[model samples]
Target: MTSLAFLLPIALGMGLCGLAAFFWALKRGQFSDLDGAAARILIDDEEDIHP
Candidate 1:
């Protein structure tokens, strides 16, 4: 009973912090080019392999 009182607020606070961080990143354009990274991996720009 006493443990619940302590744990619930802690859990909610952590969840809110995570949400805030995500929004901050979003506003800073962190997720602006989501498709760019995925497409880059598919195109291999390999140079010559001369021994």
Candidate 2:
């Protein structure tokens, strides 16, 4: 009972922090190029590098 009083605000605060971080990432374009990154990894640029 007493623990809930202390822990509830902490839990809510942490959840809000996570939500804010997610929104911040959205504003920063962190999730803008999801598919491009995945496809880029499969691309081979070996010809551009000369040994």
Candidate 3:
């Protein structure tokens, strides 16, 4: 019982913090380009180095 009293609030607080961060990101445009990100990695922008 004592341990639960100590741990439950900590667990809930952590969960709420994670939810807040996720919502914050959702409000921003962070997740708006899901498909582009997958396609972007396949592009090769490297150029030959001049010696």
Candidate 4:
């Protein structure tokens, strides 16, 4: 019973922090190139290779 009093606020605060980070990422366009990254893996970087 006493543990709930201490744990509830901590849990809610952590959840809010996670939500804020997700929203910040959305506003920063972090998810805008979702498909580009997946497709990029299929392309080769020829310049980086050395013989």
Candidate 5:
């Protein structure tokens, strides 16, 4: 029972933090475009300069 003092709050805090981050990401358009990155990778970037 004593272990609950440490474990319960930590678990609750982590869950809340995860939910907050998910909500923040939703509000900030983090998940707006799911496919653009994959499409970008397929396109050749001619402007890139590599040594």
Candidate 6:
């Protein structure tokens, strides 16, 4: 149908936009430190301020 013709391009455009955004995040190092963040959460601060 005619609706399919219009929707197909829109879907493809959205997919391409998502791919571009993912690539941009890669270039910006967004996925570079996945493990460090998890480790940071487990780290405990030993500083005692309740003197």
Q: On residues 14-51, what C-alpha lDDT tens digit does candidate 1 reach at each position? A: 99999999999999999999999999888856663443
Residue-level lDDT tens digits of model 5 in 1-51: 889998999999999999999999999999999999879889976778553
- Sorting all predicted structures by TM-score, with the top scorer first, yields 4, 1, 2, 3, 6, 5
What residue runs in model 2 are displaced by over 4 Å at the alpha carbon? 47-50
Kindly indicate the candidate among 5 and 6 with the higher lDDT. Answer: 6
- The model with the greater TM-score, 1 or 3, is 1
lDDT of 4 at 45: 85
**How well is each residue in 1-51 modelled by candidate 3, as lDDT tens digits?**
999999999999999999999999999978998999899888876673443
lDDT of 4 at 27: 100
Query: What TM-score quantifies how close candidate 4 is to the native fold?
Result: 0.88
Stretches > 4 Å off in candidate 3: 46-51
Relative to the unseen true structure, what is the C-alpha lDDT of residue 22 in candidate 3, on a scale of 0 to 100?
96
lDDT of 1: 0.93
Q: Alpha-carbon error at 6 in model 6, in Å?
A: 0.7
Q: Please report the candidate that would top TM-score against the real structure.
A: 4
Instruction: Report the candidate with higher TM-score, 2 versus 5.
Output: 2
Q: What is the lDDT of every predicted structure here?
A: 0.93, 0.97, 0.92, 0.96, 0.93, 0.94
CA error at residue 13 for candidate 5, angstroms: 1.1
- Full-model lDDT, candidate 3: 0.92
- Tell me the TM-score of each prediction against the true structure: 0.85, 0.84, 0.83, 0.88, 0.81, 0.82
State the number of backbone clashes in model 3: 0
Candidate that would win on lDDT? 2
Comparing candidate 2 with candidate 3, which one achieves the higher lDDT? 2
CA RMSD per model (angstroms): 1.8, 1.8, 1.9, 1.1, 2.0, 2.3
- Candidate 6 regions exceeding 4 Å error are 46-51
Sequence-dependent TM-score of model 1: 0.85
lDDT of 2: 0.97
Tens digits of per-residue lDDT for model 4, 1-51: 999999999999999999999999999999999999999999988888965
